[model samples]
Target: HPWVGDHPLSPKSVIRDMYERALTFTELVSHYELARTEGIVLRYLASAYKALDHTVPDDLKSEDLQDLIEWLGEMVRQVDSSLLDEWEQLANPEEMTAEEAQEKADQVRPVTANARAFRVLVRNAMFRRVELAALDQVDELGEMDADAGWDADAWGEAMDGYWDEYDDLGTGPDARGPKLLIIEEEPQNALWRVRQIFDDPNDDHDWGISAEVDLTASDAEGRAVVRVTD
Candidate 1:
């Protein structure tokens, strides 16, 4: 009596109702497909990198010696040459020459904090998508060092591996490949589905505390076309 009178009914009902409605794989897939993305990846980073697309060079992760050099060259090309030269001067304990400091400041392109951070994220994503172990170790402070921070050899190897793997798979944007989309971006649809499931009194049978999960894959309007054998 105490438990019934004092205990909150909402939480208990929520949990119990979910327990009763054991949604099958078909239902899950249907829900996800209703709100799936049109492509394998989101276009946020791809859009950002589009500016460099023309000059970005065709980088299919590097494969051989030429590829490694090409990747390195791409990285260097994106950087203002004077920035590195100035860095060399400032790295030493000795005072930086006025010309060197001025050049560095002047050569500094308009890279906002957000842009820099996003580039780092894209780089990390590239490493991850390639299954490079080094991706896990890269950090914000470590990359800031410019010269001593990043290992060019390791990067080259990762680039090579990534491209090599891609080549073996024979995949490209135009290539025929399968893409599986997941997640229901719209909450309202999912919420409505859950409500319909929970509102059904037959979701959980009280006779023997048994649960009835919809296992059929048919697309019917109502329960009139369905039956339970158990």
Candidate 2:
């Protein structure tokens, strides 16, 4: 419990190493909470889709769950690339300068920062994806569980019980967290996704950008959120 401990840590005792760890709860909780919430919400969305017989809701004919997952992937990378992190970094942009930003302008960043930034990115992405995929315009901004008809408690339990592939993803499933969360054992969503490229090879028409691109206005056209119907 001491902010600054005087003793050194030994590996033999499980509790001994906890005291010397540098995280101090402050840095770790935010990231974990974000990942937990997003993970829970994603499972919730899956339950909703299942309830609807795996069909794209009439409101979502313009786009589907797959579109949203890809969108989340791009946002996760942006977070990793350090494009969005003031919330996780707890830094003030007015104080930060263009020159300093340039000096630290590597496309890649430390994983710790990326993990937390991803939470923020994915949280908003989940909300926006719903709207973009909706068949009709939604009246309200939030309050999705009640509107979209998801079993929140059941999905939350599923997330809590999730100890599969994600355990293998040391840093937590990278950018494809939503995709990773789905089950692949059956000839369903997951397997269908694996065969999408083969089903429509050279059919990159809908996805904003199937791969990475420069963060410029010219690339903006490719980065735009997509809507798929039929």
Candidate 3:
């Protein structure tokens, strides 16, 4: 097939548009991606593009792309106050079998109806965030995962599994109470987490924990000691 002319909607233009969208859509995407089916945000954007013009990227088929658009339209319609409840479920995991967890997520996400492309995008996005969060927690814990009974691939699988189990379990402002940040005291292995209550229901919460050898003598009493057991 002959190459399309250097028109406004050229291949190069499409590629650039994809890149630009990635950057410009970061914040809006962070909100949605952090919600559920983050990739749905991207797919929704792609669907919007398809609406403006007939062509979609070579990597994505028209039907697959259109399905994403329709799915997003449904999301736009159904999304409401209940979104918060769903978010809460994601933040706090309730005891459930893996299959049951997935079933619950499917109810919120509707895995059966969405196209493969949209699903792939959602999974990819969820995995990405889970990996980053796991890595960060690992660093903070200073615990060796090499002996955690998993290889690299296995580790990835574990993280993905955790994400699948909880990512879509619920939605809303976090109800996990306050995030705990443990800081080490002068005594080796002695650690304590800062206790703080969250006042605002809508505000996002984050806390940092670092390995500390010691604080002033007066500060010792203020910092509570935490013990970890097998």
TM-score of each: 0.16, 0.18, 0.22
Q: What local lDDT score does residue 35 receive in model 1, on the 0 to 100 scale?
A: 22
Arranged by TM-score with the best first, the candidates are 3, 2, 1
Candidate 3 to truth, TM: 0.22
Name the lDDT value of residue 90 in candidate 1: 50
Supply every candidate's count of residue pairs whose N, Cα or C atoms clash at under 3 angstroms: 1, 4, 11
**lDDT (C-alpha) at residue 186 in model 1:** 28
User: Distance from true position, residue 12, model 2, in Å?
Assistant: 53
CA shift of 32, model 2, Å: 35
All candidates in order of lDDT, best leading: 3, 2, 1
Deviation from truth (RMSD, Å), model 1? 27.5
* Model 3: lDDT of residue 190: 31
Question: Where does model 1 exceed 4 Å of error?
Answer: 1-117, 120-230
Most accurate candidate by TM-score: 3
Selected candidate, larger TM-score, 1 vs 2: 2
lDDT of 1 by residue, 12-104 (tens): 342222112322222322534522431211122122223333344566432332322332222232333343344446556376786756665
Local distance difference test, candidate 1: 0.27
